[model samples]
Target: MSEALEILKKYWKHNEFRPLQNEIIDTVLSGKDAFALLPTGGGKSICFQVPAMMQKGICLVVSPLVALMKDQVANLQSRDIKAIALTGGIKSDEMIDLLDNCQFGNYKFLYLSPERLQSEWILERIKNLDINLIAIDEAHCVSQWGHDFRPAYLKISNLKTHFPNVPFLALTASATARVKEDIIKELGLEKPVLYQESFARKNIAYMVFEAEDKLFKIEQILKKNPQPSIIYVRNRKSCLDISSQLQTLGFKATYYHGGLPSREKDKNMSLWMEEKAQVIVATNAFGMGIDKANVKTVIHTQLPENIENYYQEAGRSGRNRDKAFAVLLTSPSDRFQAESQFINTLVDKKFLNLTYNKLNNYFQIAYGEGINETFTFNLNHFCSKYNFPVLKTYKALQFLDRQSIISLSQEFSEKISLQFIIPSKEVVRYISLNPNGEEIILAILRTYPGVYEMDTVFNSALIAKKSNHPEKEVLAILEKLKEKQIIEYRSKNNDASLTFNEIREDERTINRVSKYLEKQNQLKKEQLKSVLDYVKEDSICKSKLILAYFGEKDADECGICSYCITKKRSPKDPDALSKKIIELLQNEDLNSRELQNRTQTSKDTIIFALQALLEKEIIIVKSNNTYTLKS
Candidate 1:
């Protein structure tokens, strides 16, 4: 324990360990398996990191998130701790070299995805390494009932055969009782010590509000709490639209989504992190592995599919132990949307079979072939080619990837090359006739000096920026130039790749994993139902409800939740509220949200008071949605 603490101090500059971290670390150091269930921002990484550092050999950490793996590896390197991540997209020779480095480089940590362990050669190489511990991050994925179930995780138990004595540590931020049991059973942990911290966050007041005008409500929430915040939307378009709207409404806001270029994502995230932007409107892609203390509020504008996701995302706030809010803004249409988006898009065995058959056909794979074959997969292009629904097809591909039928790598970017075929004088004459192509051609020629000499790779985004046009427009101009034989052009539009792990027995493949797929679909429905219940159940305390979902029983009512506040404010005093509203309006015009904030009451009470005042003609609503006392 002393050694662990010393390592923590030396590297992290922290004197004391967080709750439950010490016990988990002690269990691992004693050569015993451990299961750790800590909430977000509870310092889960430190438990495995500090303990692994105290020992001699490398710790093999299996994680499902590539972004998180890169971040941790970078962070450890910055602190001079030797670490390496065996992520995807590496050549076979490069992967072997990395394994060799892990064997002889005196590294302390080796991070890789669970899917990487599927290869027998890799497993053989791993057995050769002097491993001290096996830490499984996001261990809930091993469970069938877990929110993010991956079939590849079940194969992790194979490690026990290779290294019988190495202790395994399983860690997760959010897991239900079933998930916990499954993690223990699937990981083959031998009488592991379990450390579960309470899921309750006393500082966060979980509140659910049904709003007709959600933007107005969001504005009210943001206006009242003028601190660093995150507003979660459901899609990339919404991220852009809502952030733009907020900026138009005079808020310092930025946007983040998965489709954004990495540079843009980092810049937008930095803007919000450095306080240059007060809020970041983003999709679910933004907050994993992020620790942002002092976030006063987290608002979700749409309905989340499950409670686990909502809890993990909302838990990002109030880490500094300050009073914060987890606000969920719902509407009458949210339930239908949730069902249509989540439930309807769930791929069953039939859809899976069709997708697998079509995919093999698209690549012209023989029935008994395509094992270990890889191809660049453009999702939009495939969907357009087959006239398949984009969402359902994507889900099918993901299902195949999860079932280990194929390894889908979404990190693949298109390779493009260009070379001018005509001389400079011919190009100038062509540009004079084709004025629309002039800017893009000039931008590319200016950017790439040797376009006429050889095929030069270029960034379309940079060309678009230089030409003051959208990337799509620039691509179109280049395609036109290619058609006219003015330039040589080649581009692969696929931003993803798929590697088949099995032969193309389409029906057999789908049949093999059909049961798991059906069970997953059912589990998703149940999870969504729980989320709907949480949102609609106004009688119970929201915080207690979340705790109970995570198997925490007999929790006391959180005094700060909407239900507790409303329950305490029973026997409504309508007349008194109306009088309060009149007095507030006499001083200055205010909206319902402002009145609710100032009066420390609910929106219903404020609305009721304003309606009563308007009925008596004592107050009137101004053009800007504020109520004012009649002159």
Candidate 2:
């Protein structure tokens, strides 16, 4: 125990470990493959971090979330631990430099996306590094049946064959019985030790409200709780709209979504982390990597598609073991919308094939030509060119990626700017001959420093504001200048910001692949519904429901849950009056005589008691006949 404490103090500041964490660290230190299924905010990272500190070689952590990797790496660096992430944002030369550092710089952790496993150069270089363990975060993503499946994760099993002696650790916050099996099989773990912490969060009060107006209910909830909270919506536009509404209502609110620029997202996250913002209105994309422990409430304005998502998101609050609230706001209309979205995602085989073919045709690639080719896809452009719904097309592409039919690069956009070459006077003279262009030209020159030298990317809105002109006018002036060869201009097509690398196939083949993928998606929806059914069920204990879902049979009902507490408070003999009424009826049809005969009671009590029995239909009144038990 002292040795464990020493390791903890030497690396992390803690003198002790969370429940089961020390045991997990010890197992990894002993060089064994382990699967850890801890709930959200259960110190999963420390399990790997502490072991990595005690190990003899670097620990290679493959994570699906880039934002999470960046955050973890920053934290590690702040602790004076050498850590680096090889992400898509880095240039090839820079990546090579980083990999070289990993090979020789004695770095203890190398974090990367699973897709990086496909990089031949990186794989070749790993042969020389002493990797003690390979840790896969969000291990559930490796399973096709998991809520968030990534095809690249399937390639991870190859690592076992490549490094036969190295130990592995797979960790996630949530997984069903099927998903657990899939993860074990997909990763090729050999009878790995499984550690599952109870999913019950006793401190979180689970409340579900049926709402006629969800927004109003949300406002009411905020007014009551009035603490640092997160209101999760379903889309980016909702994040903006709801945040705006909250501000109008005099709440300190901000919004976060994937559509925002990375810097803006980071800024909003930082604000929330620092508690400068009382509430964050966001889509599902916002909370994955957040570690703020004192989140007082998590209110869902729209019903989550499934229970796993609901559980994970709602579990975000109450991490400090203090009382917190997880509220779900649902209306009839919202339920219909959610159900519709689920149904729409069920694509027909013919439609899937047609869309797949259209995607191939849009890329001008034959069936077998696109295996490793990287192409930039514009969702809007693809929709316009192929007559497909933009949102559906995007989702279809994601499904294709999950099906391992293609690999997607992260999505990106282009920014164009101009740099000045000669002084403003020289450029003025060059374009002075064109009448009616001087104002726009001067505006352009004044807005940008080196407009005549080279092409640069500048924010269009900023340029418009500086020039005191409409953006259209500024763009026209730049285009005209480019035609005259007075300045060079180029459009930088940022990486697709998202990429989809289709597996090589003949265009005509795999047209029916979409049907199978759609079926798999429907099956997943059914599985999600089953989880929700457990939540809505009134008979089973809440703790027992969760435990059963995880394949733990024989778990007792936690007396602290709402269901158990309600049962405890309920009257044991609610129909006690019925028996007394029946006894009175045994002699003759008696109106209120039953109460007196059964027990000494007042007139008001007798009337109330008679009303309760009548309401329950336990007794019947024949036409003009005295009341008696309905036999």
Best by the TM-score measure: 1
Against the true structure, whose lDDT is highest? 1
Candidate 2 structure, TM-score to reference: 0.75
TM-score, per-candidate, Cα-based = 0.84, 0.75
Regions of candidate 2 where Cα sits further than 4 Å from its true position: 367-371, 412-492, 495-508, 511-519, 531-544, 552-631
lDDT of 1: 0.89
**429-521 per-residue lDDT for model 2 (tens digits):** 777677566666665656654444334445554556556677677678778767876666554566453343554454344553645576577
Give Cα-based local distance difference scores for all models. 0.89, 0.75
* Candidate 1 lDDT by residue in tens digits, 1-631: 4888899999999889889888899898889999999999899999889988988899999999988999899989999999999987788899999999999999999999998998889999999999999999999999989999988899999998888888999999999999999999998999999899999999999989888888888998999999999999998667877888899999999999876668998999999999999999999988987888999999999999899999999998899999999999999999999999999999988888998999999999999999999887777557656778877988898888888889888575435778899999999999899898888889998988767865565667667777988879988998888899988888866578789999888788788889999999999999999999999998899999999999998899999987887788775588887777778888888988888878877767778778878899999999999889898
